[model samples]
Target: MRIVLVLEYDGSNYCGWQSQSESCAIQDAVEKALSAIAKEDIRIVTAGRTDAGVHAFYQVVHFDTLTSRPLSAWVRGVNAFLPEDISILWAGEVPDDFHARYSAVERRYLYFLLNQSARPGVHHNKVGWFHVPLELETMQAAGKLLVGEHDFSSFRAAECQAKSPVRTITHLNIVRQGNLVVFDLRANSFLHHMVRNIIGCLVYIGKGKYSADWIDELLQHKNRTFAAPTFSAAGLYLAGVRYDPSWLIPEFSDFPIISNGVLR
Candidate 1:
């Protein structure tokens, strides 16, 4: 049987989602736990790979195993052996055709920024800190220009391995609550460091250092150097992934609420 799992993790101490040769990774930790339960080697595939210091609220993965364990065992049993920072939120049997990565229809990401003069105290590795007041309206207006399908070469990382930079941004929202600014973005897929790079440019526009039109110019130019530098990965979160309803995967409802107000 194939089992699908919803995972939540703090990426502060891990190398990233993918397993690495020399460093600890979230995938390695989870697979190790699951393998212990199954009493055999178990491999898994994730919906999206988050960078180092990037967190995930609802990461999805699937593994094929012959071990006939109950859903509770897969959840609680596996988590018992996992590290404190990684967890298994939900687990269920999925069809053979259900893929954790290829079956995902959309992926959502959220970037949290502490925009205040003082540095963050409690949210040190949980949020990106900007020691300047940000104009919420300006950031929202600039984000709108990035909606729809376009060549996002300017926002892509130089080490990006995506075959193409043209991805559709179905939704882009900016919200602010006190000194916390939230950037919510949804797309079919994203290139490497795409969200962080976009947030860097948005921060520049929010600070009034660049006009909203600068976003459009950067998009048109299709040059990575024309855009702002990539922001910190601490603020980035893999919010969720959408799959076809026919797959009958369990639903996740743990997305953070924008408490203040929606800017756009």
Candidate 2:
């Protein structure tokens, strides 16, 4: 049977989501706990691959197995063996055709940036910080220019292995309630370092380094080197992944109520 699971993890300590040679990868830990339950090898595929120091509020994955257990077992049982940073939130039976990566229609990300003089202490790895004050007005103007379908080559990583750089930005909203600026972006899909790289450019504009229209030029140039350096990964979060309603997967696209001095 095919199984789908929703996951939430603090990626500060893990070596990202994809399994690597090291045991510190989130996939290695999840597969280990799952293998224990199945009494056989268990491999899982995720909707998105987050870089190191990135967090996820709602990450989706799917795995296949012959062993049958209640859906709760995949949740509660798996959490028993998983570490404190990782967790299994929901589990359900999925059709053989359902895929965690390919079935996804849209993905949402929330970036928490501490825009203050003193660097963040309590939110250390949880947020990206910039000492200089940023203009929310200009950033919002620049973000609007980024909406719609375009070849995002300028904001993509040089080492990204994705075949196409053409991804649509369905939405991009930047809001700040104090020193914290929250970037809410929705895309059909994202390339490696795409969000962080875009954040770098937006920050550049917000800090008066570039005009709002500079992003327009970057999109036309399609040169990765012309863009700003990729911003810190600490602030990025895989907040949500949306799928077709026919699939019956849960919806978690809304931003959560944040406190803890990070938002306000």
Candidate 3:
């Protein structure tokens, strides 16, 4: 049967999602749990691979098994073997044709920032930091610039392997609550470092370093070097993945949550 597992993890301790020869990873940890339960080597194919120190709230992975394990067995079994940092939030039977990565119609990410002179407290590890106070309203206004189909060469990693630079930003809502400035962005897909790069540019705008009009010039140039430095990965999170509602797990259907995507 083909099964989909919803995952969440803190990416602070390990490398990216994919396992490497050097260090531990979120995939490696989840694979280990599956191996222990399935009593055979198992691997998970994720919806997307997050970079090191990046977090996820609703990451999805699909795997197959011949074992006739109960749904609870899939969930409890995997969770029992998993470490504190890596967790299997839920597991459900998905259609054979359903793929965790490709089937996703939309993927959303949130990059958090606490705009203040002082450092963050408990939530600091999960959010990005800015030393200078920013104009939240201006930043919110600037976010509108990125909401449309455009070639995002200026906002992607130079090493990005994606064939096309064109992508659609369905939503880009920047809102301020207290001292926290949250960037909510959703799209059909993303290029490498797209959100971080966008955030960097937006941050500069808030700091009065870049004018709202500058965005058009940057987009037209399509130069990666023209963008500000990519912001810290720590502040970013896979906020959610929206799939067909019919595939929802019975118990975890209502509350949407997942891992921190951190290594520790």
> All models: lDDT?
0.90, 0.92, 0.83
What's each prediction's clash count?
A: 0, 0, 18
Candidate 3 lDDT over 28-147, as tens digits, reads 888888988888788789888899899887788999887778878788888999878777777889879989888887888988888888887887578899989898778877788889
Residues 1-264, candidate 1, lDDT per residue (tens digit)? 999999889999999989998648999999999999999899999999999999987899999998999899999999999988988988989889899999999998988999999998888899999998999999999999999999999999999999998999999999888788889999999999999999999999999999999999999999899999999999888888999988877555543333322222
Tell me how candidate 3 scores on lDDT. Answer: 0.83
Clashing pairs in 1: none
Q: Once model 1 is optimally superposed onto the true structure by TM-score, how far is the C-alpha of residue 25 displaced, in angstroms?
A: 0.7
Q: Candidate 3: where is the Cα deviation over 4 Å?
A: 249-253, 256-264
The candidate scoring highest on lDDT is 2
Task: Please give the ranking of all candidate structures by TM-score, highest first, separated by commas.
Answer: 2, 1, 3
TM-score comparison, 2 vs 3, better candidate = 2
Higher-lDDT candidate among 1 and 2?
2
Q: What does the lDDT read for residue 49 in candidate 3?
A: 89
- Candidate 2 per-residue C-alpha lDDT over 1-264 given as tens digits, one digit per residue, 9 for 90 to 100: 999999999999988988999787999999999999989999999999999999998899999999999999999999999999999888999999999999999998989999999999998999999999999999999999999999999999989999999999999999887788999899999989999999999999999999999999999999999999999999998988999999888878333434421343
